[model samples]
Target: MNQIDFITEIQKHEPKMFGLAISILKNRDLAKDGLQESAIKLWNQRDYFQKVKNKQAYCMQIIKNWCYDELKRKVNNHLRLQDDEEVEEGIGNEKDHVNDTYRRIKSLIEKLPSKQRLIIQLKDFEGLDFEEISNALKMEQGSVRVNLSRARKRLKEMYLEQENKIKMIQNEE
Candidate 1:
């Protein structure tokens, strides 16, 4: 494919790519950087493109790897981003408050095991169909469904449990 075609192909998948990146990175700025990096990597490896049978899959693989590396780097550096912390702390009283349901959802999502979190984010928030989610995560469609269900179930349980605990405290007071 020529440069224009290559650009077009990547652009076609841009929305999905951005969603995947944000889900993985959990930071808009970082996700944008990761997406840019993915495109740059694809461009650099363009000569080998023909060797890969599925360009979309190949680009996804690249993004996944880059996200992993970026996450690793963040962990190693012990980056404590204030925004995520605020969300986690339920401090939505400010102008940036995302609302109770979404806040609870985000809280539960953040508490999920890494794999489950990613699955839920892709399926619930990004609106990737089962097949697309499976393809992106390299899990089977059934597995994706099961994982997503479990994630939602767990979130529901946690929310109810936490709500009860708060009620108990309030009653005691």
Candidate 2:
């Protein structure tokens, strides 16, 4: 692909790439950095774009790899430190139940295993099909479907469990 075409294609899929990064990194600032790095890397390797059969998948893979590397680096730097205290402090006023529920759901999703989370994010959030997700993650299409299903099922169970807990607490009141 030429310079213009490469830029245009990256722009077209930038949102999806950002979403993938955020899903993996679980931080907007870091996701932006990952996306920027991925874009630069992709631009530098523009010569190989012509040989790529699936540009979107290739771009997603680049973003995913960048995020994974960032996560690993973070783990190495803060092996004993935990960020949960900071995250809890950032929780807004209790009056906003909607925001609380949203945060809870997001947190639950983040707790899922890496592969399941990636499959869920790519397939459901980014609207990528099984084949696309498989290509991006380098897994079989069947494995992608299975992982997505398992992720969704696990999220549903978590939601229901939380709902029951809330009901039990309200009952005591």
Candidate 3:
């Protein structure tokens, strides 16, 4: 891609990178820093983009790596701030259900092994095909699909269990 194409690519994916970062880091400021670093890294390797079969996926992989690094750094540094916060307070009541679901999903995602979580996020949330995810992850296609499927199944079970517990609690109430 050329100069204009590169700018457009950045514009298209900037939000996704930021969102993914925030999902993993749970801090807006830290997410922004990770996005900035990813953008800089992409810029430095602009020429290498031509060789990539899927640039967006490649950039997303970069962002994913940065997020994992940030997560490790924060935990290793022993930060006391709770990872969960009430950031959805401004979304209004109408979106509360969806936001709650997302928060629950994020919590589930957090519990996943990093490899499984990465596969699920790339395949499910990001809407990438197996081949694309495999290429981005540098893994075989079958491995990517297996990981994604397992992650989704586990998350589904977890959500169902949580739902049942909530229902039981409500009945008790």
lDDT of each: 0.80, 0.81, 0.77
Off by over 4 Å in 3: 1-3, 19-26, 68-84
Q: Taking the tens digit of each residue's C-alpha lDDT, what string does model 1 give over 1-173?
A: 68998899899777777878877877777778888999998888888874777677677778888888988887899975333444445465773455666776787788998788998888778777887787778888999888999999998899899999989999999
Winner of 2 and 3 under lDDT: 2
TM-score of each: 0.76, 0.82, 0.74
lDDT for residue 96 in candidate 1, whole number 0-100:
43
Give the per-residue lDDT digits (tens) of candidate 2, residues 86-159.
23344557646766666687778877998898789778877888877787788999988889999999999988
Ranking by lDDT: 2, 1, 3
Q: Which residue runs of candidate 1 sit more than 4 Å off their true CA positions?
A: 47-54, 75-98, 169-173
lDDT for 74 in candidate 2 is 81
Scored against the true structure, residue 15 in model 1 reaches a CA lDDT of 77
| Alpha-carbon shift of residue 85 in model 3 (angstroms) | 2.2
Error of 3 at 42 (Å): 2.4
